[model samples]
Target: MFNRIARFIPVLQWGRTYDRTAFSNDMIAALIVTIMLIPQSLAYAMLAGLPPEAGIYASIVPIILYAIFGTSRSLAVGPVAVVSLLTVSALAEVAEQGTAGYGVAALTLAFLSGAFLALTGILRLGFLANFLSHPVIAGFITASGILIAASQLKHILGIGAHGHTLPELLSSLASHLSDINGPTLVIGVAATAFLFWVRKGLKPLLKRLGAGATLADVATKAGPVFAVVATTLAVWVLNLDDLGVRIVGEVPQGLPPFTLPSLSMDLIRALWLPAVLISVIGFVESVSVAQTLAARKRQRIDPNQELIGLGAANLGAAFSGGFPVTGGFSRSVVNFDAGAETPAAGAFTALGLMLAAVALTPLVYYLPNATLAATIIVAVLGLVDLTILRKTWAYSRSDFMAVATTIALTLAFGVEIGVASGVVLSVALHLYKTSRPHVAEVGLVPGTQHFRNIHRHAVETVPEIVTLRVDQSLFFVNARFLEDLLQDRIRPGTDVKHVILMFSAVNEVDYSALESLEAINLRLKDMGIGLHLSEVKGPVMDRLKTSHLADALNGRIFLSQYDAWRALSRGGPSTDAA
Candidate 1:
């Protein structure tokens, strides 16, 4: 009971060792992350088509909840770029952007995603995440970054650009090019250029000016905050809003007001698939980040528990009028580098965001949409890894095909179709490969009791007894191949009367495989040829015993191929039931 409780709520394990040193480290890390996250939160929220304060709200309680339930000490949970984009895609389908219904739909998505994640964790079904191959994921993220950057071009051009795909966005922007607000475009372009410079140039310049690496790193991450301040100030001083500047305008102040997602069955049913997709993608991304960070410290993460943590965080986000979030690679790295000692850092960061929600909401009123767009563009652009395409092409052409297909589909269509198609292609690629497993003909190695692949080694072999080693789990797909290979080995009236199947790499034998084996036994029996088994795994032997296969196997089951070779070649009883 105690173990179960601790497993569900991981804070109990880490909280037991809380100390003043840990407190100090966590506090400092939290401070640095809070400073960095403020501008990011507001920007990401805007990107998700929510009120700016929703981003701050997202960072607040969700962090606290994740700290309480999460297993990782360094994983900082909040609104991240991919999850925010997913949120927009999910909500955009149900209601118009910026509508009350859209907001409700976003909250419901968070809740559903959180629930799905929590259920998977409880069932310990985290291994299902493996379905999304790394290459496919990389392709999806790269394409997603492109789409996100393209989508934000409306803010950059100061026009009413609207679309989900890049082409549509371009077309829409072109249609409204004549109506582009000059004032807004100037501010937007300037802020975007300044932020890009800050990200690329600031740290190097700061280090040359005697700034330490740690301080420079923090300041570099805080560059967007500088953009927000500068642009907001310019807008206010120059009365830029009066001249077509799209400011954030009024933001609701105070704590994140508690709310509940719409439970209407129609809404839930409509948003169900998107919620599940968001949950799965979010979980995969979170686990990957958590594992990488844990490796640096020689610590380990429980993927199952991570699901629970992220689930709780998303649930908090839903109820608090935020969107889905996960463990962001950049933020988690910053937390680790800033020397966070425990999950307390997340809680402290939450407190910092809460303070921002209460007091700093007014300061961002003059913040230009262009600056927020700039922040998102700068952040997600790093997610675009074109190197993956080259690497996949060199590594495996099949993987390259999958990666290329996923990227092209994502960009040409929208996010939903892209993700769905990517998953299907990944599964298809796996099945196509596994359906044609590598089968090797084996022979006796020189002066050894072991068998070796005939092609790879100079080994002794007998024409009468052919041995095959299958290097994959036996299932319906490749079951027929086994029989076909056996038939090719056997001649009409040859000396070959015994066939030995060496089951070394085969871990599982499904019903279809068993049926295939029975067919082999029956056919070999009709031909007066014996079908033998060597090195049958214990579990497989037990399973065979449960069926009539052992009784009607047509030949013997040897402990090893060497024993079978010794017994069969001795020319004992050549003719039996087989």
Candidate 2:
């Protein structure tokens, strides 16, 4: 009973083994992650069109919930760039930004996403994520990174621009070029450049200045906090807000507010699809990061349990006045690198964020939106990798088409359409390939029992006997394909009298395929040709025996292809078929 309960609540399993050393390490990691998450939460909330405080609210309950139910020791769950962008996309459809309806819709989306994830976990449907191909995911993320970076330029330039796609964003920015505020532009560009420099050069400079490696690394990870502080102080001192510079103003200073997501049927109908997309994308990203980080330490995570954990976290967010969130790649890496010993680190980080929500919230009142935009711009730009296109192109044309189509559709249309199209295209590509399964004609090689493709190998064949190697499972999609191929290969005037199908590679024979095989048997019987089966797998043979096709077969089933070849060769000339 205890083990079963522990399986569902992972923290219960790990908590008994917790020690003092773990406590020390977790506290240090928590401090580092808390510092990193504060600005990120605020920035992502703003990106989601929520008040900055909502970001901090999002970071708190979600982390604690994930720590309690999640399987990863280092995965820090919170408002991520992609999920936040998705939140904006979802809420935008139902209500105007800054409206109460918008905030309620955000909560509803989170709840819907959480509900879907929890249900999937309960039903053990985590394998559904595999249907989304890696190339498609890479393409979608790369395009989303570009879109996110472009969307932030409006804040950087202090201009009004609104769009979900690349072309629309670019056109909006172009039209608003004349309205760029000089002060905001300066802060945005300077902050962006500074953050970039910090990422590339600051750690090395700190090391050169006699800082230890750990100190330098921590300082490097805290680079965004430095930007926030410097810009916030600069605006506070210079009164840049008076000069048309936008700032994160008046963040609510308190514990996360108790709230409930809207239960309106209309809102649910409008947001449910987006919620499902968010849940799938978020779960895939989170599991990937969790698995990668766990691999580094020789640990493992349960994917289904992770679904439950993330579901619980999002549900916490829905009830706590926040948007949808996930395990962010960057923050989780920071937590891992900072010496986190367990998910206790995440729980500790949540405590720190709660403290920040109460005390540190007021400090960011003058933090410039341009700096947050700069933060988001720098963070998401790292996710953009167009090399996947070149890699896919060099490997497979079909994969290249999927990646290219996903990228183009994402940039041209939006996130929802791009992802939907990628999934559809991936399924279509799979079906197309499987529908025309490879069927190779084989002949016996001389002085050996082996049979190889007649077209590719110099082999001996019988003029009156033919053997075909079916390389794929026999299913409804490709059942007719095999029928047509056999009819074409064995013409009316040909001397072919016996046909053998090598089923060594075939794993299944569905009902439709069984019907096709029966049809092929009847047709061959009409033409005075015997249809045989060789090397049928045990399971497939058993399935075949369940039907009348096996008894109705015109020729005997052989245990092996070589046996069939040997038995049939006694009655024919061993010359290669023309």
Candidate 3:
């Protein structure tokens, strides 16, 4: 009973092992991530079309909850670029930007998304994330990066521009070109360039100057905070705000407040589609981060447990005056590099963010929105990896198709459309491939008790006995295909009286497939042929024994195909005569 309860809540597993060493490592990692997340959280909140402080609110409680419930040792949970873009996309249609209803709808999205993720975890439905393949995710991220950057261009230019897609954003930017504020442009351009340089060259340059690796890494992570501070101070000193530059003015100072997500039926109905999309996207992102970090430490992550952890994190965000969030790729990598020893690191990060909310909110009053936009641009630009398209295309055409379609749909229609289409496309491709599984005609390899596909090897065969290898499990999608295939191959009044099915690759037999097998067995029975199974896997054999197929057998299940052939063809070929 205790173990079962602990499985639902994972803090029990690591809580006992928490010690001073773990605490110190966590605190250091938390400090680095908190420094990085302060500006990022604020920028992502703006990206979601919410107030800047909402981002801070998101990072605070969500990190603590995920740390307690999540399985990854180093995964940092908060406003990721793609999830934020998706959040804005989902909420934009329901409520106008900057309205109370918009914030409420965003909160509601977090609630619905959290509930959905938690339900999936409870049901152990982590396999659902497999529908979004790595290539598809890469393409989607690259496309989302483009969209996020495009969306932020207005803030960088200090103009009022609004759009949902690439073309729309570009068109709006062009229409508002004359309204661009020069001071905002200068700050945005310079900060963006400097941040990019800091990411690409600053670490190596610091190392060359005799800085230790740890210090260099921390310096690199703090680059954005430096930019925010430097730019904020500049705007305050240079009076850039007087020149019509938009500033993150009057951010509330305090820890996150408790709030209830609106649960109106209409809100639920409206956000349902976006909620589902966010849930799937968030799960995939979280699991990938968990698996990668776990691999670094030679540990294994429970995908199902991770779902519960991320679900709990999102739920925490919803109730804590924030919007939906997920495991951030950059932040997780930073935590891993910074030597985070456990999920406790995330908890410590939450404490740091809480302190920032209380003591640091007033300082950002003069922080230019362009600086935030620059931070966002630099952050999301890392997510854009067009190289994946070329790599997948060169490796596999099928994967390339999935990636291309996801990218195109995401760029053209929006995130919700891209993710939805990617799922549908992936499922359809899987169904298509499974509908006509590999059916290999087999014969014995000379002097061996093994069967090989006839087309792939030179083999020996008895003319009267034919063996076939079914490469896929018996399922509803391809059950009839097998039936038709056997019918087309077997000739009436032929010398073949015995047929063996090599069940090496067959993993499952659903009801529809079972009925089809029965039909095949009865048809072969009428034709005076015996159907036998050889090399049936243990679990499949167990399932067969529970069914009536064994008792109603045309022949018998053999331990090996060679044994069946020898028993059935005993008189025809014998070593004793030799």
The lDDT leader among the candidates is: 2
In model 3, which regions exceed 4 Å deviation?
1-5, 491-498, 522-530, 538-557, 567-578
For candidate 1, give the lDDT: 0.87
Model 2 C-alpha lDDT per residue in residues 447-556, reported as the tens digit of each score: 99899999999999989999999999999999999999998998887899899999999999999999999999999999999998988888898888889987898987
Candidate number with the higher lDDT (2 or 3): 2
Score candidate 3 by TM-score against the native.
0.92
TM-score of each: 0.95, 0.95, 0.92
Which stretches of candidate 2 lie above 4 Å from their native place?
Answer: 445-448, 455-460, 571-578
Q: What's the lDDT for candidate 2?
A: 0.92
User: Would you list the C-alpha lDDT of every candidate in the order shown?
Assistant: 0.87, 0.92, 0.88
Give me the displacement of residue 115 in model 2, in angstroms: 0.5
Ranking by TM-score: 2, 1, 3
Ranking by lDDT: 2, 3, 1
